[model samples]
Target: MAKTIQCTVVTPERKALDQTVDFVVLPLYDGEIGIAPDHAPLIGRLGYGEMRLRRGAEVSRFYVDGGFVQVVGNHITVLTAQAVPADDIDREAAQQQLDAARGQPASTDEQRQIRDRTVAQARGRLRVARQAHP
Candidate 1:
């Protein structure tokens, strides 16, 4: 049998996941990184993308806006600024948000920041849903 490690994903609103998995693949600020059982302890900053968990034949995915990840022993903990399980995302709503954000006229720096965040959120949602169902 394959060995697994504990993985917990938390966002400001709630703890989205707490499970055991053979490995985890996360989108770090720099790039994608994989974590496995007994992985060396480390910490990393995450970016907008999908977190993929693999255990046996089952695989799950989630979207994270940005966060930090800590790995120690046989456990990985993710503290995210924002996160959503793929199943919880509404594709139509995400698309609408993306469209609305894009349609807004360029203005102040605050508007740019909002646009950027909205785009990132939409991308993360798309990434998670694609990976989860594909």
Candidate 2:
């Protein structure tokens, strides 16, 4: 049998997931990172992308926005601003959001930042949805 580690994903609104999995892949601020049982203890800032968890032959996926991740003692905790399961994502709606974000005019730096973040999130959602469907 494959080894497993506890993984918990939380958002401001609610707890997204809590389970034991054979492996986990997170979207770090710099890039993607994979974790498994006995992984080195560490902390990292998360980026907007898909977070995938695997257990045996089953794979679970979530679109995660900005957050932080911590790993210690065979446990991984993810605290994100937002998270949506791949099955729950609406590709058309996500595409609309991406288009809106792209078309919106950013008058200020803050507005630009927000717009960029929104675009990234919508893109992530679309990517995850496509992967789920295909």
Candidate 3:
């Protein structure tokens, strides 16, 4: 049998997931990172993108909003603003969000930052929505 790590994903409302996984791939603020059993403990800033967990031949994917992750021994806990099943996202809605974000007036620094964040979130949603499992 493969070694597994306990993974838990949490949002403000509730615990979204709790499972044992052989491997996990998470989107960090700067890039993507994969975690295996016994990985060195650390913390990372999460990004708004796909989060994948695999156990044997099964893979589960979710879209995670930006937050933080904590790794300790054989456990990984994700504290995200939102953790949504990838298959639940709507492609058309995501696309519309992206378009609206792009068209938003970014005349001030604050406005530009908001627009950029929205754009990134929309893009992430669209990407996940497009590749959702059937």
Q: 66-115, model 2: which lDDT tens digit per residue? A: 79999998899999988889898888888898899898778999999988
Per-candidate TM-score against the hidden true structure: 0.85, 0.94, 0.96
Please give, for residues 30-63, the per-residue lDDT of candidate 1 as tens digits: 8999998989999999988888899888878788
TM-score head-to-head 1 vs 2, winner: 2
The candidates, ranked best first by TM-score, are 3, 2, 1
TM-score of structure candidate 2: 0.94
RMSD (CA, Å), candidate 2 to true, equals 1.2
Residue 21, candidate 3: alpha-carbon lDDT: 93
Which candidate has the highest lDDT of all? 3
Q: Point out where model 3 deviates above 4 Å.
A: none
| Winner of 2 and 3 under TM-score | 3
**lDDT values, one for every candidate:** 0.84, 0.90, 0.94
Clashing residue pairs in candidate 3 (N, C-alpha, C atoms within 3 angstroms): none
Best by TM-score: 3
